[model samples]
Target: MISTAWGISFRAFDIGQLRIFFAFGVLQILNLIFISVFTLYQMLSVHTSLTLLALTPIFFMLLTTKIIMPRMAAFTRQNQEAVGLLTNRVTEAFTNIHVIQTNASERSFQRLIAQENDKVYATDMKVLMLRTLFFPLMSALTGLSQLVVLFYGGSLVVQNKISVGDILAFNIYLSYLAFPLTSIGIILSVYQRSKTALERLDPFFNETPESGSDAKILPFPNPNEVDIQDLHFTYPGSIHPVFMGLNLRIRKGEMLGVCGSVGSGKSTLFQILTRIYEPPVGTTYFEGKDVTTLDPITLRREIAYALQKVHLFSASIADNLSFGLIDRPSEEELARASRSAQILKEIESFPDKWDTQIGEKGLRLSGGQKQRLALARLFLRKPKILLLDDVLSAVDNITEARLIQEFRGIGCTMIINSHRGSVLE
Candidate 1:
């Protein structure tokens, strides 16, 4: 019964702003009928009193349906928001559980959960208080209306204007009407709360994502080069500039090394290259074609990036390496790429070899092993332009030297971003 009531209440409220207009029309119609019927009943003969009594309960039920549901909806929506907030808190804490434990913040987490719980509890109590007050007040109002009907009708019966049987029937109808009239307040409350919930969810329904522009068309030119001219950028909500008039270029088959201090716009430059962040008042051209005009997906596919923080999915080594390759690569091709990355030997040592599962973010592997695995994946991509962002940082000097030598041999247009220049040399 509660579910059915909730569904009806929600439907009435969520049908849009038309709810108010429709509700107003309904209330006006009910008011007119209610006034007209009572006035006519007072003037009608005693024989007609029974007919009026029969409709009284039906009129009260209509009042309950139209009036009470909307108010109940408002309270329900408030409770839902409180629950949503509590759930968000729990999810955020769980996601950052490691950091919380590391900092010994169990008490702080508990306090936050407690605070959210208390807020929900208080809101629930307020809703309960409103419900308690609404029911009794409605019941009293309904009883008073019945009392008026009985007194007036009884007097008419005593004066030989109405029959006793007619008066009794009228009283019975009035008694039946009382329950429905009292329920009207509850119905209105339900409608109101549901309306509030739909309003709260409106933003998500109307949301437009950041990328809504049409893609530009530009063909690639000869000499397959990437150029950044007078580029400038700053992150959203940040006051300081991440990049200021930065200019760089990478020609086909040219290996360019990028060296800078920590937080010196290296990663920001890569982000712009990937078109994750739009460059301010400047252009990045790839193979003589404006990168902004080119599709971001195509640009990213052509330009491979291997970051210091390597991320590997929980899948077999072979699956991770061949991620972007269309039509699964031959076993020989996969082996060749793995060998170049110097991780094939390590994989072979594992019990499952290429089929071994690398746990989330490659947690099962050592830092150097993870870096090698990421490089292996990058090698499999065979991109035209490779962006190696501190890929050798985790490996030892010997391994870094060999990897750099191996990378130089690949002959792709490479931009190596790292503080250590010796690896590049």
Candidate 2:
């Protein structure tokens, strides 16, 4: 989704502009041929042999298309790939600058970027050399064709086969062909570059989006129970399994607390429940129906997953709280949600209150504040199942207790994972 929105979006606009330029190029070529054909007919009427002389440049054009064009296209593809890799490296570096600074690994990152930059530079030079060679090669071939025409047509004039006026007129017509012929090479180069870009973007455009069953799944008799049976899951491209024959069931309206040490699949369980990473069909169930058969859009509507690593947008507190709601939530509704999540007082303490602007990923807030903000957003949605993945870990004991009481009163089926036993109790 990020690649579709950011990387391919700008290139889509460039493709549109290329389409416009290519259309104009076609029109110019058609106009050149129309005028050239009339001029050729007049010269042919003067001397039948002169037709052969006018076509001498065709040999040069054929040479360029057959030999030079394929190589140019190959180099263009390499250049584009190199540039894309460099851009990704630069973006990753900036995104993790804080990590690099704290670890004192700036030099290592610089070396990595320099390696990618070197590759980009090499490919760019190859493309530049080809572009530089094209125009001059066309000019030399055109000049050579002109010389051939001058010599042959002058000889025809001396032999009284064609007059001096006829040779001059033929020479004038040939110059008109020069610009169009040279432009054809330039047009083809641009087309090849555009074609390569489209090829790279093809997978993203053709990728099957997250889809649900086209036919409606049968309604569950009990719509509140969450169950897992004989579950076995291994992440793609990894041999190690996260779950093997795991079985569990959470009854309706039950507040099930999950506790485990780090790297013991506590987080992975929540991910499977929320369908962030899909488990095998028939293994995971929600609303008493096979989850894989359910519409992810509708399924997710009733399931809210507040991640351990809270992600907050760089926006006002009210906007963050009201993030997923379809309707514009009233100020009163926002306050109520915040209060339920134990975050209302801190927000109200700010001079701007609900309108306070949180920096990127809530950089202006503490870890506890970010987690509470995410919970507040989830509470506003009023989902059927709440998957809180260590959301209270960062808060103080008093706050955690208050939030725990708040969760109990909500009366929803809750799957709470935590490192602290107090949260599970």
Candidate 3:
């Protein structure tokens, strides 16, 4: 993949997207020689010029740069933060475009986006000015060192303390020394940029790690039962709890309808059960075992979740429907699930049908289409338990009724969160 014409996409790309580099770690070992040789050579051959004149200006440059570099780093940090704000605004604007249109709040969004853009422009200017200033300052420091050597070394040669040829050699050596000594500043700058990249990547390190030997092997989780006992949970850094002393039990082949107002923790309950958010120990259990103790991979594979806001990647219809299954779903199976979700007729109407490429997050599909497609994908999995969060909201009454009838035909345990009383019926 690395040698291919397409490397990584720059859009939303970050250090966290270093899968290719980490995979080819051995291939990068050769490049290290260049950095090591240049850096080691400069360190060893630093004092080639013995005179006080040659050494004085170099030391002065070092002292001042140490002070200036910290300021440059601060500017870089602010610039990154400004860029982050711009990114967030762009994401938010696109995601809630429907809401923006419904409320006719384009002007309000325009003003807010303009404000964020101004912040980005101001921070960028600061970084550019500091960077431009750095090069000129470096040039002046190097030039002054050469001037000092001529004035001082020439006088020494004329005084018979040193020969003219000796003074000439000293001048030539100073020129050679200057290149590597000046390079030190460039190296420090590269270091600063790399540090900033690492900072951008820090959040990935905070994610919950995958299970290893320390995790309990749950080879056989009872497909029929899920239980929550006295579950009290809050998000990280949040003082208030979302679920407090919550208890629920779901037995084999039972269909549970969950209905609540907004902010009532319906979706959160599913997230905790699926181990997307770790719950307190002894709080939630699957197959009669604590959910926390179960291997995360096993937990996820056995349970299927479909959220209200469906997400479909930019890919062919068949690919999206078969995304997680160990075996590619056969055409017959695809047709069955799509039919169950009431999307098969629409999908077959496409010129390429299953082969047709859907735009990003199924942009080409209508809201009801996306929801049906997501449901069909989960249906193909035939997971032991289904966690559907308002999946039927977008579809019309007749279509939703048809879907619910087919879904119950599968005979799997299901927990559905829906606001529609018709759905509950």
Q: State which candidate has the highest TM-score.
A: 2
lDDT of 1 by residue, 58-176 (tens): 46655654564555565566676676667667766865787999999999999999998898898778778778877777776667656666776677778987777877765665665
Clash tally for model 1: 26
What C-alpha lDDT values do all the predictions have?
A: 0.71, 0.80, 0.77
Candidate 3 per-residue lDDT, tens place, 265-349, comes to: 9999888888878899898887788887888777788888998789899999999999988899899999999998899999999
- How far does residue 55 in candidate 1 sit from its true spot (Å)? 10
Q: For model 2, what is the error of residue 350's alpha carbon versus the real structure, in angstroms, after optimal superposition?
A: 2.1
Lowest summed lDDT window (length 10), candidate 1: 1-10
Per lDDT, the best of the predicted structures is 2
Candidate 1: list runs displaced more than 4 Å. Answer: 1-89, 123-212, 220-223
Candidate 3 lDDT for residue 209: 71
By TM-score, rank the candidates, best first: 2, 3, 1
- Compute the lDDT of residue 104 as modeled in candidate 3: 100
Off by over 4 Å in 2: 1-49, 212-223
Alpha-carbon TM-score of each model against the true structure: 0.68, 0.88, 0.85
CA RMSD of all predictions: 8.3, 3.2, 5.6
